[model samples]
Target chain A: MPSAEEAADAVDVTALLERGRTLATPVLKKAVDRLAPPMNTVAAYHFGWIDAAGNPADGDGGKAVRPALAVLSAQAAGAAPEVGVPGAVAVELVHNFSLLHDDLMDGDEQRRHRDTVWKVHGPAQAILVGDALFALGNEVLLEIASVDAGRATRRLTTATRALIDGQAQDISYEHRERVSVEECLEMEGNKTGALLACASSIGAVLGGADDVTADALEKYGYHLGLAFQAVDDLLGIWGDPESTGKQTWSDLRQRKKSLPVVAALAAGGPASERLGELLAADAKNNDFDNFSEAEFAARAALIEEAGGRQWTADEARRQHKIALEALDTVQMPATVRAQFAALADFVVVRKR
Target chain B: MPSAEEAADAVDVTALLERGRTLATPVLKKAVDRLAPPMNTVAAYHFGWIDAAGNPADGDGGKAVRPALAVLSAQAAGAAPEVGVPGAVAVELVHNFSLLHDDLMDGDEQRRHRDTVWKVHGPAQAILVGDALFALGNEVLLEIASVDAGRATRRLTTATRALIDGQAQDISYEHRERVSVEECLEMEGNKTGALLACASSIGAVLGGADDVTADALEKYGYHLGLAFQAVDDLLGIWGDPESTGKQTWSDLRQRKKSLPVVAALAAGGPASERLGELLAADAKNNDFDNFSEAEFAARAALIEEAGGRQWTADEARRQHKIALEALDTVQMPATVRAQFAALADFVVVRKR
Candidate 1:
């Protein structure tokens, strides 16, 4: 039997893949220009362009993961595949918009193998960039509204609000300590799951799915998002950068209040005390000064010793099972369900 | 004889005069849970609550101008008086959103007789607040969408994009040496006019007007925005702080590419050359020894002699006439139109 990871990869089936890029770049292009210059050089670095200093890099960046999820969803929901492209582009743009702001909010120095937008263009420019991307996303939605002109209204607005709600909690959680498992899940639910779910549910809406089907897709994506985040958190602490694009043990060193760390902190004992001390020390040093390799190692030990990592992993598995159940109940073709199911497994279990 | 300025002030009967405070505060509070206490403090400071340091100010600070216009337009459109309160609150929040980011971009130190949000809360937290405000604006729009659903979808999405278009041009012009008068107006239309237009037009939409009526309200507010900005630009250069709450001629000193200055430069000659020198000198001054105070005074004299002020004043009047015509076409109540007309006059003539 094929492994679950391989099954998820089947979601991107060579057979089911649409024939073209097939999305309107012109309508989206004006929104992009209205938001940023074609020649800001730095701002154009994403969506395929030269870098900030006006030099060419390898190529376009970021996986367009959210947008793809959106497009795939529309297709899976049985919409004319081409029709959902605008919404796909829209959801993707919204995702990038969040990334732009989140980087600045987190003071993250790097993204996509280069300096983050704020670091390259200044924070003001970064903020404007995020605003532009957001506006473009809304613009794309309006274009889709023109296409449907009827039901498009409610669906697009709901998705946009869900987008904002997700981000609000993500930023809010940065300085928070003692985040409960449920709270972390809620934060992720809004910050990541909500958008992912919107991507699929909106696709279903575009595809003309009934409310029940749309709701099922939304749940599937929600669970998928939780699993995706859990896997990402795991990578943050333990994965290798050649694959993940980050140095190992970053989450630990940064004292990120991820689900795993939250679990460790909530456990409260020798392991918990040690983890708390490590967090306090990191806070004092800003995870920079006096944070030696030994300290990092010690912190990781405390977290694992407290069973934080295992708890988060188990949580991810539980959510994954729920996602499977949601997909199973969707009344979709078995082939399609298997593809998404496999994809869900891939997202949650990826080593990177 | 009633001067146009006098008539305009009289015409702009403030909307939400009764329900203004009630609508604004509660709406903002509901959108967000103050997850970060320090951020709450930062947002409070932006709202003109406590001084930047967390000490309470005497009382309310902002004039609620934008929200008032929104309410008035709703009423003028023959909607119930209480009907458009949420839209008013939303527009005001968006206005503040831009203000928060603008101060950070400009690196200004003060607002509303106290330190700016970034200065008090630092750049990171201020960024978060601005993002939150922008997000909340969308949420309010989503709330609007729930009622009309279709119109809300098209209107808010379009409005959001228009605002960003305005902002994009505003930022881009900062780097250009010589922007034309037409370009200046286009920029003003987007950066400043669009949101003001949206505020009024949204009210009309909420009031259940047909598209034609809503379109007219938008145009009215658009022209009004031009008039409003012209007056604001004048104050930036010449108004006393006792009135305008900002330094006199700071716009000139900073070489701000406002309509008056752009018009003066486009006219060219010895005056333009001298003004150019002042601008160039200011930029090159990494050290402040580039020019003596007398030299700066001489350039100022050149600009004054070139009639930049008179030219701007004339243009402001021209725009005001267009605004009045648009208002006449809007099919609003005669009394309401008269009130808005008064505000239009005040926009062109207001000292502060």
Candidate 2:
């Protein structure tokens, strides 16, 4: 018999995501349209609906995975996917809001293979646009004008606080000399897991699911977010630049203390020691100005040799298994459970 | 007989602000405490509750004007002052959130005679902390978990969007050659008026007032905000630097197209024409690199000669009158109405 993973892989995730986008995009567009002139223009460009010069364009706008989670979550609670449209739009807006601010904070120039909002419109507009999107997200949720909507807004704002805390921790870690694997995981959980948890449960909560069910779905998403981050960490170090829309060893260039780096430094050996020394020296010099492509490649090789690569990959699988197990605990429809499992699998093993 | 303004001005505005601060500070501190580590530290410092080293200090945590409006609105609706605490905290948090981000975007180094958060910590922390405070504001309102809470949240978020829109317009205006007084008023209305309107009415909404009463209170606050901004504009240019905590002719040095500048340009005289030319030339060069305090003072003199100062002062009085008129349309306790008038008088004439 085929393994459970293989069975889960049979799910048509592309169709699921397409359904979510189909349902959520119009509402999302309406919210963005409410923004004033230049903000509306900037947000439109950021969403890939327009070119930098404001002409219409068909560009990548992510996979709409968060929205899919939300719609699926409402369905898991035996409600129509339409019941979750507001929640889906709210999560997507919050996700994009974070991206805009994070891009500016990280000094990143490009995203989705195009110039970032800050790069094109300058930092002020980026800040304002991110703020506008965030406010728009809250507006969308509260406009529901029900007790459940209040509960949902509370969840979103709480998750947002965690997300911001994670960003703060991430920035602080860049300047520190040593970071434990536990510390790294906590940061990742807050940064990535918290919002995903909110995305996974907010729709169900809005759909009038009991707290027990909502909490279970949130646990599923929390674990899935950890799995997703591990895969992203791996890609940051070793994935194909074409797939990631980034340069090779992109994380190394930014001197990020991602999971792989933290795990490797924790695994003590000659190779680990040497890897630590190299990173310390690079950090002390504070700039990769004198470094070359060969240097970054060498660092990546050292991390792999120190077992960082294999460890992170195993952690991803481990978290994916836990995520699926959380789904099994919830008494949802088999098809809904299967969809959640498929999303977990996709999160772990996807190239980008 | 004494004029209404003189009678209203006798209401001891300082005591009113003090009462607001006393009622609102603890809850505000509790909300700030919920923020994760470094964010909490940055926020405490920003609110003037602590020094850079985290020692407690009695800093000027604003005049608590927004909170007073919220509490008084609730009282006017026949609810206790305590019923308005959540709304007061939400508006105060939003105000500080905007200040943090705006200070960074404006590249302002000091606030209230202290280094700004961005200057003391870094740009990334400033952005993150501002975002955290905003999320916290939403959390405070929605945690009430009622339909009314949802309505209040929607109002706050809508106002927040308008606030962000106004900021966007302000930034865009900086790059343009000319801005009409009407355009400037629109921007100020969105930026300052919206939030104040929300503050003034949210408590009443939460206190179970009907829409008409809430709307009347909103109008009262909106006009008050316009009047308040006018006084702020006057202080920006010609107020004593010792009281303003800024250099003389501060707005002119930054080349701000505040109400005074816009109104003066609209006055259409030789001084207005000369002032416009000077500003246009300054914009063409795009930097005040070679400008001196004397030049800024000369610009201020030209604005005053063009009737900008007189027009703005008159405008403040007009808006204040309208704000009081809004209060007359609402049926409330006489004492409550008197307090509202007192606050309006204070806003129009306050030095700082």
Candidate 3:
């Protein structure tokens, strides 16, 4: 009976995501169109909606997961999904803004199986268009006539500041030789958790949900966000190339201090010592491309042997359980609660 | 008698700018402090308050012209200058945000006699700190408890979008060979005019001014912004390097499609033809460093012979007149009105 219920929940989650994409795309289009040309063209390409030449393309824009969370959270707070469309659009825009800038800053060449905005259009355009999208996010929130627009704007801006702060710390961490687990979690919470928390609670605020309900939703989103990052960090090293749209051991190749890598280094064993030696050698060369396939595989083996993989998996589950517990603190409709639970399960369990 | 009054107005304008800097510096400092380190450090260095080593530096941060305009505009709307401090800080932040990003985009190494943020730090850090400042601007405005906070946020966001659009156009213009004077003006209006207009009018909105007063102030700002650009364009070509902080014919050396150059190309005379040939030759080599001093002098001569220089001067005066006229449409207090008129006079006639 439990297995049967889980299967139904999976199907429902898929349908909910589809509904979110349908409701959010048109409004997102309108917001992107508000930007002038070149910026508009650059943004369209980044969004996977249009080619560099301004011709439309059939492209996938992620799973619309954040937007779906917003709509579902709003529904859980007693408003229709349509009522959360503005919040969904705002979060989606902010998310893309981060992606555009991050791609440029990281010098990443590809995203969603295509050349990134900076790679195709140049960094200057990427920076400006990212800024435009951010402004548009703010504009979209204010355009909503709800009495909560001011609060929503303030909330979104606060989350955005946290996001920027997180990005700053992430960049700084890369330069440092050592980063503590506590610092990593704090950075993840700011970088990933803040926006997700905002996405989860903004809809409730817009829906005029009571303070208790909104606070509960926020906690749920925060824990879920941390869980999502842990899962993403795991996938970064271990997920299939086809599933993750990245090379195998991509993070390891780049010497990224992801959760598992950091954890393994901190564990201090033979495997940890070997991993540290290998990473230090790579750092000295300052070239990841010099690393051979065997070296990549060996590094992964060391991480796993150091118990990094098990620890990260366990941490993800722990956070996921806490997220669920937070959701239980709220008394939403049973159906809405189930959707939230399903989404949480999807976040932690997905291969990608 | 008129000359005596003009001299008095100049002194008063200087005093007003000093007062604006004094009031806005602490607020700006507080906002910058909100950002975490590395970003906070980069911003502090950019603002001329500190050096790259985190030591204090006695450096000037431009003229604080935008903040002064905000404070004066608030006074014109019957509010105290302190009432407009948030607006002043916000506009100043937005202005610095543009400056930081522009320096990175243009590969400019120097600003106000110091290394640019990107030059001192890196482009990625510059980009992130600029984003942080922009977000801080929005956050500061929303922190105001007055009813106008929402309206102010909306107005500032609108202007920021326009400013970005202008920047996009400006970058696009550099890649194009034949930009008309009309297009250049439009670009300047967006890049330079929009923020100036926002700086000029936001205080009025925050002061709870009537619509008529706000509209007049906006128009005043728009024209003043155009006039400011025109003067800047002139200074770009012919001003003393020591005063302008740039080499003579700096705009031409970079082949920037500034207003005067665009106007000269559109003139279509013998001088225009010669200027076009010279520019085409320069564009082919893509090397400004190879040009001789005689060639630079010749290019400047042709621009003047084509009426570009004279036309720009006349246009500056014309716009200045229009800006002052727009201010006349409002019936603010006599003292505030005199300051506005004085500032207008100072804008067009300043040597640097």
Best by TM-score: 2
Range of the 10 consecutive residues with the lowest summed lDDT in candidate 3 chain A: A1-10
- TM-score-based ranking: 2, 3, 1
Q: Point out the higher-scoring one by lDDT: 1 or 3.
A: 3
Q: What DockQ does each prediction reach against the true complex?
A: 0.37, 0.82, 0.65
Q: Fraction of true contacts reproduced, model 2?
A: 0.90
> In model 2, which runs have C-alpha deviations exceeding 4 angstroms?
A1-7, B1-10, B285-287
Point out where model 1 deviates above 4 Å: A1-43, A53-60, A146-178, A210-212, A268-270, B1-41, B50-61, B146-149, B287-299
lDDT of 2 by residue, A44-129 (tens): 99999999999999889897889999999998889988888999999999999999999999999999999999999999989999
Q: Which CAPRI level is candidate 2? A: high
Ranking by DockQ: 2, 3, 1
Model 3, C-alpha of B9: deviation from truth (Å): 2.9
Alpha carbon deviation, residue A303, candidate 3 (Å): 1.2
User: How much is the lDDT of residue B174 in candidate 2?
Assistant: 84
Tell me what fraction of the real C-alpha contacts between chains A and B each candidate also makes: 0.34, 0.90, 0.64
TM-score of the A chain in model 1: 0.86
DockQ head-to-head 1 vs 3, winner: 3
Whichever of 1 and 3 has more TM-score, that candidate is 3
Label model 3 with its docking quality class. Answer: medium
- TM-score of predicted chain A against the true chain A, for each candidate: 0.86, 0.97, 0.95
Give each model's whole-structure lDDT: 0.68, 0.90, 0.86
